[model samples]
Target chain A: MKGKPFFSSVVQKLVIGITGLLLCGFVAAHLAGNLLLYSTSDRYAAFNKYATTLHDMTLLPAIEIGLLVLFVVHIGLTLRMQFQSQKARPEGYAVQKSKQGRGALAARNVMHLSGIVVLAFVLLHLADLRFGLRFNEAGLAPAQTVLQVLRDPISAMFYTVGSLLLGYHLFHGFQSSFQSLGFGGERLTRIVKIVGILFSVAIAVGFASLPIWVTLLRK
Target chain B: MSESINVTLKVWRQNGPGEAGRFETYPLENVSTHASFLEMLDILNEKLINTGKMPVAFDSDCREGICGSCGLMIDGQAHGPDRETATCQLHMRRFSDGDTITIEPWRARSFPILKDLVVDRSAFDRIIEAGGYNSINAGNAPDANAILIPKIDAEAAMDAAACIGCGACVAACKNASALLFVSAKVMHFARLPQGKPERETRVARMVAKMDEEGFGSCTNTTECEAACPKGISFSNIVSLRRESMRAQCSGRSTR
Candidate 1:
C-alpha cells in the first residue's frame, strides 16, 4: 500500500521463525520414530511397516511435496535475511564485542548453528536413516537389529554428535519461534521459555540415548 | 583517597561544521578515582575558564543518565569501558593512573558536529516527529482501565521505552544503523493499548524518516546492544519488523 510494498524485514523474520519451528516439529517427530529402535524386535519392524503404509498406502507423496515447498521457502527467506543483515554492516569493526544481554550466545548465532545441524543431518543422518530407508527395504529384523546397526563406533559417535547439534539449534529456535509468532508476552513468555529449556534437554537426552543404549547397554 | 593520577585527555575541538577540527591535549594533575568522568571534565573546564582560556565545549544535563543529553566517544567507545552505562554515569575508577582518554562527538551523517563534543542529534527528534507519537485527541475523559492490557505486554513496552534516545547506537554501529533506536520507539507504543490507534502510521512514518536521515540498515552486528545503556533486546527489532508488515497490509494502505 504505502511506502515499500514488497518484501520487508518483518516478512523475513516471520518466514525464518515459522519455517524454523516447522522444521523443529519435524525433527521431534523423526526422533520419536527413531527411539522405537530401542523397543522390542517387532516394534522396529512395525515402525518400518508404518513408514511403508504412510509412503504407499496414504498420500505421503503429497506430504513430501508440501515439505519440499516449505524447505524451499525457508531457504529462500534465510538467504534474503542474511543478505540484508550483511548490507547493514559494510565496514566491519576492528574489535567487535557484543553483550549477552538476556539472551544466550547460542541463541544469538541461530544461522551458524542451523548450518552445522543441516550439515550433520546430511552426512550422517542420511546414511543411517534416509539411506537405509531407501536401499534396505528387506526390513529390519527387530529393535535389536536397529540397535546392532547403531552400535558401530562411527554410527554411535555421529548419532551422539548430531543430536547435540540438533539440541543446540533447538535451544534458540524454541524461544525464538514463540517470539516470532507474537505469542510471547510476560506470563506466556516465562512459561514458553521454561518449556523451551525442557524441550531442549529432552530432545538432547532422548536422541543421545539411542547411540548410548545401542553402543554400551544393548549387549 | 585523592590520588595523583596523570591523565592525558585528547578531546576534539571544532569551532563549527565548516571550521577545522583537531584533537587538543590537556594534562591533568591529582585527579581522584572517585570522580565521575563528567566531573573530571568539569574540573578541566573550570581550570580552562579560570586561566582566561575558552572552556572546552560539551553537552551534558541530568547527570543521572535518564535524560540522554550526555554522550561522547571515549577511547574509541560509545560510552567508555563500562557496559550499558551512560557517559555521565561512568566513574573514573574504571581507568587507571596515567591512562590516556580520547573523547569525540558521535560521528554519523545524521548527527553532524555542532561544536567540540556537542553534535546536532535533532535528526533523532525528526525521526520521532515523523511518526513516533499518538495523534488521538480526545475532548472527554476515558476510564484508565477501559482497555485491558496484559501485564506482559505492559512490561515489554516499558522495557522498549527504557531507550534514552542516546545516539550511542549510531556511534557503535559501523553502518550508523538507526534500527535499534527506531525499533525501540516503534515497539514501545505498539505494545501499549493507548498507542494502538496509530500503529500503522507511526511505523510507516518513523521508518521513512530513518531512511531519510541517511542511517544505514541493521546488519545484526549487534554492536548497538553492546553500547546501549538500557541493554535493549534485539527481539524488539524483530517485533518492529512483525508490526511493520501487519501495518502495511492493514486497512491504512493509502496513508
Candidate 2:
C-alpha cells in the first residue's frame, strides 16, 4: 500500500480528538454558566445579567465563529471516518463479542449513535434559545426564555433526553479524546478517566435539571 | 496423559478469494486431548486424505507461535480460547467431549482468504515497508553502553516490539482496524534514540499506508489489545497517535 499525500488516519484522529475536546470544554463552561439560574435570590436576576454580559462581550461573535468551525469540522470528519470504517468491513462476522472492558457499551458506539442525537439537539437548542427562531418569546428575561421553551412537556422531555445522551457521549468522548492525542501512563489515564466521568455527570445533570426545575418546581 | 474425546469440527471451506465460503463439518472419534489444535487438524487431514477427499488448507510455521504465521478464528475468538496464546499453542484439552468447534480465516477487507483458513496478510508487510524501520547506519558495532537508553524506555520499546504481526487483532476488532499492529511497530522504533532521525516521517508514512490498505480507523474499542497473541498493549496505539500528531504539527512527511 502506497502512502497518500493527504491527511493520514493519525492526523484525522488528531483533528477529531482536538475538536472533540474543545467541544467538551465548551459544554462544561456552558453548564457552569447555566448553573447560575438555580440561585434562589432575585428570581434568576444573576442568570439574566450573565447572559447580557455574554451578549455584550466583544469577543462573543469571534468565539461563536470559532465554535461554528469546530462543530462543522468535528462532525464532518467524524462522519467521514465512520463511512470509511464501515466500508473497511464489507462483510462482518457471523458472531462477534466484545472482550475488552476498557470502554463501556455507551462508549463503544457513542460516536455514531449519540453523535447524530447530539447534532440534532444542538440545532434545536440553537434555534429555541440562541437564535430565537422557533420559540421566540420576545421581551422575556433569559431565564424566562428558557422557562418559556421548556414549559412544553415534549420540549422538556427532548431537552432532558438530549442532555442525558450528551452525558453518555461526553463520558466516552472525554477520555477517548485524550487517548487519541496519545496521553498515556497508567496513573494519568486513570485520573483522566475519573475526571471524564465526573465531567460527563456534571454536564448531564446540570443541563437536564434546568428543564426539570423550570417545568416542575418553578411554579 | 489426557484422555481422548470425540468431537466434530465445523471448518470454513472456500475455493478461492472472492468465492463464497461455507462450513463443512467433520466428526472424529477418540482424538487425543493432549494434541495441539494444529495437530488435531493434521489428524483430520490424514483422515480426509485416506478417505480420498480433499484435505483442509491452513497456514502454520515455526509451530512454537513466534513466527506469526499460524492464525485461525476458533469459535469466534482469534487464536483460540487461551489468553496470550496463538492457534499453534492452543491444545485440544480446552474442548470437551462432543464439542463442536468452528474455525475460519482472519476476516478483513485487507486480508482476503487465499483458501480455507489461510488469508493474505501482506498488508502488514506493506505497512512495515511504509515506515516500520530505522534507516540510520551506525557504521560499525558500537559499545552497548554507547546508546545509554533509560531502563524504562528500553522495556517499553521491548514491550512494543513483542507484536508478532499475526493479524489476530484485526480479526477480533469490530471495525477490523490494524491500529494495534501498526502502532506496535511504530512505537518500537519511536521510543529509542536511533529512531529519532526519521521518527516524524516514519509515523506519517506508516499511518498513510495503513489507511491506504483499507484498515478501519480505531475507535478505542480495545478488542485488538485483548486478541493480541503477543500481549501488545493498546498504549502503543496511543503513542502512534501522539507521534502522528507531532509529525503533522512539525510538518514532517516522507511522502
Candidate 3:
C-alpha cells in the first residue's frame, strides 16, 4: 500500500519481467550489430566503422550503466524469488509427478543455470573483444579481433556453447516475460510464444554463426 | 462394478503444529471398490477406534466434494489420480490391489500442519477476508434478471468461481504459490458488473494478503492447474497480473 520500492511478489515479478524484456531487446540489437562482421564488401572496414560509431556516441556510457543496473536488479530479484519458492516447500514429497503443459525441463529451470553460464560468457567475451584485452595490439579492427579470438578452438567452443545456452534461456524467458507483464488472451499468448521462439532462435544462431564463420569459412 | 482391492496406506502422522511427523502404514483389506476415498478412510478410522489406537485425523465434509473440506495427496497427486475429481469423489476402485499409497497433508508454509493429514487453511480464509466480497447494503434482494450479464462473461465468471478453496493448488505447486487461488477470485469478481465497484481494491488487497500469508511468487510453472480439482486454468494468473498492475499504476489502494 505504501509507496515502497519493494512491495509484494507480484510487483517484484512485474519489475523483473519488464527489465527482462528490455534486456531481450538489447540482446537482439547487439546481435544485429555483431552480424555486420560478416559483411563481404569491405575488409572489416564496415565492422570497424560500426564499432567506432557505437564507441563515439555520447550516450554509450549512460546506456552501459543502465544495462549494468538492469542486470543487477533482474538477477537479484530472480535469486530472491527462487529462494522463497525453495523455502515454501522445505520437505520433499516421496513420489513427485512431473507437471503437464509447462514445456521442457531445461526451459523451466534454465533461468538460474543458464543465467550463470551466460554471465560468465559475457564477462569473458567483453574482455576478449570489447576491451581487446587478449590482443597485444590495442587498436585492431573489431573483425580482426573477433577472428583472432575465434581462431582459438577453446574460445570458439565456449562461444558456440554459450550461444546455445543463451538460446535455451531466451526461448523460455521471452514468452514468460510477456506473461509476467500480464499480456494474456488466448490468441495473443500464442502469438507471443511463437515470436519468442523465433527471436530466441535468431539471436542464438546469429551469434553462434559469427565464431563458426570466422574460424572455418572466412579466408 | 470393479472388484475390491487391498491397499497399504503410508499416511503421515503428526501430533500437532510444529510437531515431528512420520509415515504410519495401515493395511486395509477388502475395501469396497464402490466406496469413496473418504469412506475408505472412515473404515480405517473405525478399525483404529476398535483396536483402541488413535485414529488418523483428516478434514472432510460434504462427501460429494462440494464443501471443499476433504482433500489428501494420494500417491503424490493432489486430490487423488483422476483428473478434475476431488478426493471425496474418487473411488477406491482407482487403486490396484497390493498398492502402497502414500498419503500426505498439504505441505506449505502458509498452511501449517495441525495434525496428521490436516493443515490450518485459515490463510486462505484471511486472503478471502481481505477482499473476496462485494460491498452491498442490506435491502430487498434485487431481481435476478435485472442485471442481464452476457453469457460469455457469466461462463468465465462461473469457471473461476468453480474454485472450492480446497488448497490443492498450493499443495501441488512446486513454489507453493497461491496465485491460482487468488487469481480465480480476482477474475470471478473483476468480470462482473456488481464487482467492478471495488475491483481495484479487491485485487490489491487480495494480492497483499496472499503475500502477507507467506506464499511464494508464481513463476508460471502451472503445476497448480494440473493438480487443481476444479480444473481452474492458469490463465487467471495472467489476468490477475494485469489487474494488479493496472491498479498499482493508477495509484489506487484500499490499504
- Listed models, DockQ each: 0.11, 0.59, 0.59
lDDT by residue (B1-255, candidate 3, tens digit) is 457889999999999999999999999999999999999999999999999999999999888878888879888889988888899999988888888999999999898999999999999999999999888552466788888889988998999999999999998887889999999999999998888878889999999889888888888777789888899998999999999988887777654
lDDT of 3 by residue, A74-147 (tens): 99999999898888877767766644644436575557888888888888888877776776576777677778
| CAPRI tier of model 2 | medium
lDDT of 2 by residue, B66-172 (tens): 99999999988899877799999999999999898888888999999999889999999999998898788856867879879899989999999999999999999
Q: Given candidate 2, what's the lDDT at residue A180? A: 89
From the highest lDDT down, the ranking of the candidates is 3, 2, 1
**Residue B162, model 1, lDDT:** 96
> How many clashing pairs per prediction, in order?
1, 0, 0
TM-score of chain A of each: 0.80, 0.94, 0.91
For each candidate in the order shown, give its overall lDDT on alpha carbons: 0.75, 0.87, 0.87
Error of 2 at A14 (Å): 0.3
User: Each model's fnat?
Assistant: 0.13, 0.62, 0.61
TM-score, each model? Answer: 0.72, 0.92, 0.91
For model 1 the TM-score comes to: 0.72
Q: Give the distance in Å from residue A154's predicted Cα in candidate 3 to where it truly belongs.
A: 3.7
Off by over 4 Å in 2: A1-3, A101-106, B5-8, B27-29, B249-252
Interface RMSD of 1: 4.4
